[model samples]
Every structure is written in structure tokens, then in C-alpha cells.
Target: MGGFFGAALKRDCVEDVFFGTDYHSHLGTRRGGMAFYSPENGFQRGIHSIENSPFRTKFEKELAGMSGNIGIGCISDTDPQPILLRSKLGRIAVCNIGIINNAEELCNEFYDSRLASFETMTSSKVNSSAIIGALIAQKDSFAEGIRYAQERVEGTMSLLILTEDGIIAARDKFGRLPIVIGESEDGYCVSFESFAFQKLGYKTRRELLPAEIVRITADKIEVLGEGNPDALRICTFLWTYYGYPNSVYEGVTVETMRTRNGEIMAEYDIQNGTLPDVDYVCGVPDSGVPHAIGYANRSGIPFARPFIKYTPTWPRSFMPQSQEMRNKVAKMKLIPVHELIEGKKLLFVDDSIVRGTQMRETVEFLYENGAKEVHMRSACPPIMFGCKYLNFSRSTSELDLIARRIIHEYEGEEGVKYIREYSDSKTERGKRLRDEICRRLKLTSLEFQFLDGTVKAVGLPECKLCTYCWSGKQD
Candidate 1:
């Protein structure tokens, strides 16, 4: 979903904050903001709509006029943030990264108690950061307020608060997201991505524990609270899809995991004697490229770039509001090589098949360019439920997922009971589900990575990971 970066430096920290936050640009597409605190100028903050432009281009000119040594910034998919608030906790600027399922209820509770009211956004929705700030303000100290907010929110929340002294960083209660600290001679930095601070000449200090809270300054890092190690449930999709290639979380790099996952998938196919007869193996561009390389290396197949993403004009496809528009942009970005696709049996690896609409369109595009047969391999299992911990998808209903829709068609209301069976490709229900998806998308064949294979690829114990989207088991 979203990412944040904060720096507490002995010298001017604006430059570090600017670039550190820019490193997280790929995480969110809606709003970008930065707030700085200095004794000379007080808190100087800027928020911009990055729906059309990148973070650097939008904030470059404004950086020259602003300066501070302690700051916090974020790239948000939800509300505009780095919301400045003056409460009993003092003048602190806060930015949040997480969803709040009980936002409306919380807002009503505040309203009924006459404690506070929130500023609404374009959709008349209360800004989550503001609500969080109010919740934090209810307590006596920053640590207490943070714990109070963490205890009340149903969904995940990891935040950074900027004060005159330094910045306070808090990871989510369940460790659903990550917050890492980096150290340098000048000061300390906190970020959602480890690589963000690494690029700023800072060494990796350590990642904050689940539900841990810390206060950072130019000289020292003080732990305000410790998290529960046994309650960790980090989102597994971060490695499979959302995380940046250079970034590492839970000691696992995203690109490395993807490559391993692809290798595992290929190994399974080879063992089962189901390796496809294909002229070339290709990825779905960008994120899927590394996975395909691993597959090619394992299977002794040639990896080719049959199509390249034309990002000169349309940098991000998700920036568009409507699904139809997004789909159009996605098609327009792919510049296919007819020489490779013409009269060739091509196998493609994608991160995951969500709604299947875009994958179907991509397959049709290949056929239009004279592809003989197209086989699809999904790097992860089919998503059976919507993500509750993060704002990963825009689907409002479970039926919005293609797998759920198919399950509904096959078994009506009773199909929900067989989600595990449908996820297991070896089972009869799973085989039928795969066949229907392939038939609908006009693909020659389809295969998805197994849950065990995915866990093995991640190099983590199954109990430590969150597989709710695939298994619907929150605990």
C-alpha cells in the first residue's frame, strides 16, 4: 500500500528526507507529502497530488525554499497526510500507512463524546491520519497515545511523528508492515523500505519489533515500547508483488524470493512431467521479469522479452481512476515484438491473477500478434479473499475476485467451503477451477504455485507469515 520516510539529522535533513521519501514513490500513487521541524522556522510542510507526476518533479522546486533537521514524509494511496496537529502531546506532525476498518465508528465515538471532529476528504471520508492524531492525542504521552491508537484500530497501522526534538516511529501491532532504522554519523533515519536509508549513506541498524515504538534523534535511538514477538503476521504478498526489488523485509529481499519462487514452480513442473513445450519463456514486464528468468534458468528454456513497457508517457498504469481506463493504459504501455510472438508457443509468468480481466486482454493481444499458443503461470496462488490488512486491491466485494466469482458459479453459496480444495491444483475442484479460468481466458494451459512452494520460496516458517488472501485464515 503505502510507504513513509523520516530523518533526524544533526544538519539540514530536507535533502535526505526528500530523496528517502522519493525512494518509496513506487508504493503509492495518490498523495505525497513532507513535514519538517526547525526551531528557526517552526514546522514547514508541503503536500501535493502525485496522480499525474512523480514525487521528485512535483516537490523539487519547493525543496529550495524549505529547510529543517527533523522531518517526516510519505507517499499515500489514501488521504493527504503529514497532517500537522497541536494537541496535549505538543505540536507534532504525523503520517500514517495502513487501513482503518473502524474509521467511521471511531469518528462517531469522538463526535458523541464531544472530544474532537475530523476534516473530511473529497469523498466525505475522515482523513485517517487526522483520526489517528486525535486518537493519539487522547493519551498523556506520545507512547501511550500511540499504544491507544494501535489498540483501537482493527486494521494495520505503522506511523512516524515529527517533533522539534526528533521523530517517533511505531510499527503496526501485528507487524503486518515493517519499519526499519538506519544510522549515520550525522543522525538516524526511519523508513518503510530498508533500501531507502541505505541509499542515503546510512547503515542498517535494525528493524523495529512488532508493535515497537522508538524515538530517534541525531545522537541516540530510545525504545519507548517493545512489541509482542509471538503475534507477528507480516503480509506475505510484499515479497511476491508490492515490495521494491532492492528493498528487504524480514531479512528476505523481494527479487530473491521471486526468483526462488519461480525456480520452485519450475521444479514442481519438471517433477510432475508437466513442463510445457514452449519456444520462449517471458515475464509480464517489470515485476514479473525476474521470476521468468528463474523459471528459464531452471527449465533450460530461453528467456526473452517479447514485449517491453513503454514508460516514457504512461509511467504508471494504476494512476488512472476507472478500471476501463487502467486496462487501456496497461495495453498501451506494452510494445510487443511481433518477430518473437509470431508462430511461437510462449509461456508467460505474472505476479498473480487477480480479476483475470487484464490477463485475458493480454492473451488476446498476443493472439492478435499471431501467437500460436499461450501458457500462463501465476507466481502466487489465486487470491480467494480481499486483503484486510492493507489497501492492496480496490475490490469492494469478494465476488470482485475472479476466483470467488468462479467458485460462486460452480458451487453457489457452498463453494466457499472448498476454498482450500480450489487452491490445491492436485484436487479435482482445483483442476476444474484452473480449466474454467483457462477456457474463459482462451489460454492453452494455466498453473499456479502451491502454498507450500510459496512458503518455501519465502524462507520463513508458515506460522510467521500471513496467507489470509489465499487461505482466509487470519490467525
Candidate 2:
């Protein structure tokens, strides 16, 4: 995954551009880049290979002597972005977030046509920069080109383009990703994540609609096109894993949704008679931290980071391809802080447990440090079905993980047939399924966020989100 930030300002926007882009460091670990357009200089692009370090430290030297009235930046997991392209329309810098599912087919068609040539970077299938360039080259007008691109692309995209005249922001047609605008005295800012506006004193403007395109300059802002008001397909997984705590994608804060999820989980526990009175609440580091905070606030318990992250060795959250290496790295990254765990009945809040291998190690670590009993709470229910839309490459096969292990033991040879039932929230079968899962994991108790609670917490109607991972439903 990657994130982008762009701004058009009255004053030089280099500092704002630099720091705003730096705030999206956690989204991707491979590359950090920025492109600026100044009155004097046409367009300047800066990229830093940040595989081993933070974006701030890696791009600090690149910040010197780089100034522009309008600029765009990206933290790329796959390819370098803010690619400067010279086309029929003119030179424009482009940055995009989201995956293109039909990339191979499109790339093959383009190659066969002999009308366009793609240059620069390739990973997985089609290169991101090349795809954006191809999209831009497909039409006569910048707006029309991007519109066609949004229409033709199979997957999600949230893009920002900086030209000599102004900057344009466009969201994907299905709205699988998020894009929001911010404003300050200097100018208007557009970012994939709202956290970019934190220290810059930029106030929140309205979020861009799915497939909407808008142009921004220092003195003017215009909507080139508005998104379809009734489009019903926004990615629901954003609430569970992708979004920042301070960020609100569709009018719901991640923190608030997480709190509601915890409450729902607690309710499920009450109905099932599995609620345990623990000394305190704790979370696995990073993403789980926010959910744990929400749980503690709701349950009136102290929230602690008993398992503190050793980020120096394990800087990135999403691991590289090797499974054996990733498992080892996950344990090394979280060293147990025994001070919080010693002789305490702790409840651990986590986003979700896909493969319980790493979590089992974590629980053992807690016991070794003198934890009397450890209870587990997950924000969302068990991921019974494998995610088909996004590149959820962490757990390769569903059968190799915890969900499958429990399901198989409970339903015998025909367990896979009952995956949909296990994911359902209201059904008595779903409740029993969760209990069996808890027993298998050797937890004091376990509960999952109800499907209704998750949808309500996200603030989007149930129709918009992709609950395929849980319910096996697809749009």
C-alpha cells in the first residue's frame, strides 16, 4: 500500500509538502518521493530509497534547495511515484494509491496496439507510474484522460496530479481508497490520509467523493467532475486495518469505530457467558494499540503496552515474502515488557488473529513473564474466508492458519462448508463457532466484533463495504 499528499499554496509549499508527505511513512516502507512545481522551475522530483530507515531521515537532505508553489509526494510500497510525465497535455507529476487488478490485460493490450510505449519500473504486473502515464495518454484532456482511466481500471485508485497550472485530485470510482482535502491560510492540501495535516495547522475540508476530480490553485478551487452520489462499493476493510486512528474516511473515526467494536465484542461475551474480569487491558503493538485504548476507555481499565515493539529491528509492519523469516521477525520485533505483565490477569486487544502462530508465541511470552491468566479480544470476528480483492499476502493459505484449525476440529471433514455460518454475527452457530475458536487457542475467553456493529461503526451503510473476508459476500 502507498499514500500521497499534495498542496497548492500562496507561499512556497516545499516545507509543508515535505513534512506532510513524511507523515505517511507507516503506509509504505520501500520509497518516499516528492514532486514540486515552481514559477521559476518547471517541475522538480525527489525520491529516496527508504527500505531500511524512516522517511524523515532519508529525505531530509533532499529537502534542501527544493521549493515549489504546488507539489505532490508519495510513500510507495511497490514503485517510485510522483512520476514526471511529458505528454500531449503537458508535463505533469502523478501519484496514485490503490491496486489495478486488470493491469496485465491492459498492459498486454497496450503492447499489442503499438500506439503507446511504457517506460519506468515494473513489480507484480503493471508498473504504477507506467499505468498512470498510459491512462493520461489515453485521452485528449487531463480530466477526460483521468476519467477514462478511472472508468477502465478494475481496482481502486486515489490520484493527485500536479501541473504547471494547478493540482488535480481524483478518487477511485468504487471508492475503495480514501482522499480528503485540507485548507490553511497558505493554500489547499490534498492527501490520502488526513494525518498529513496534523502539525501544518491545516483544517479539515470535505472528503472527495469516489471518482470525483477537483483542481486547486492558490486563489481558486474548482470541481472538474463530481462522483456518483449513489455508488455502493467502498472498501470496508479500511476500518479494521488500513486507516489511521485520527483519520475519518467516511465521517467515522477509526478510534470510535474500534470502541464500538470493543463494546460489541463485550456484548457478545456477555451473551455467551465468557466475560472475564481482568486486571488491565493491553494490545499488541501498533494497529492493535488504538483498539486496546478504546476497549480500556469503555471497560474502565488501564491500557498498557505490555508487549512493546522493538522497531529498530522490525521497522515495517507488512513483511517481505518469506514466511519463515517473517514469523521469526514478528517475535523479535515485540519484546515482552515484564513490568506490566507480572502477576496480572490481562486482556489483550488485537485487530484480528489470522494465523495464531505468532500470537501463541506472544501468549507464551506473557506466561513466562508471570501473567496469571491472559484473555484475548479481537476487534473483528475470525476471518473465515480469504480476502479476494486486496493483496492480503501475509497468510498464503487459509487451511494453514488458526481459523481453519478451529473450523476443521469443530465441523470435522466438512468444516469449509460452514465458513459463512462461522462469520455470521446473529446466528447461534456463529457464537458456538467463536467459542470453539477460543478453546482451540487456549484463551481465557474470546469474542469478535459483530457485523452490524462494524458497519455502524464505519458510519457507512452495509452496502458500501466489502465484508467478503467475514461473510463470504462479494459485490
* TM of each candidate vs. truth: 0.99, 0.90
In the range 74-111, model 1's lDDT, one tens digit per residue, is 99998898999999879989999989999999999999
Q: Itemize residue pairs with steric clashes in candidate 1.
A: none
Q: Which 10 successive residues of model 2 have the least lDDT summed?
A: 387-396
Best candidate according to lDDT = 1
The lDDT values for all models are: 0.92, 0.78
CA lDDT for candidate 1: 0.92
**TM-score quality measure for candidate 2:** 0.90
Cα lDDT tens digits, model 2, 188-208, are 999888878867989888888
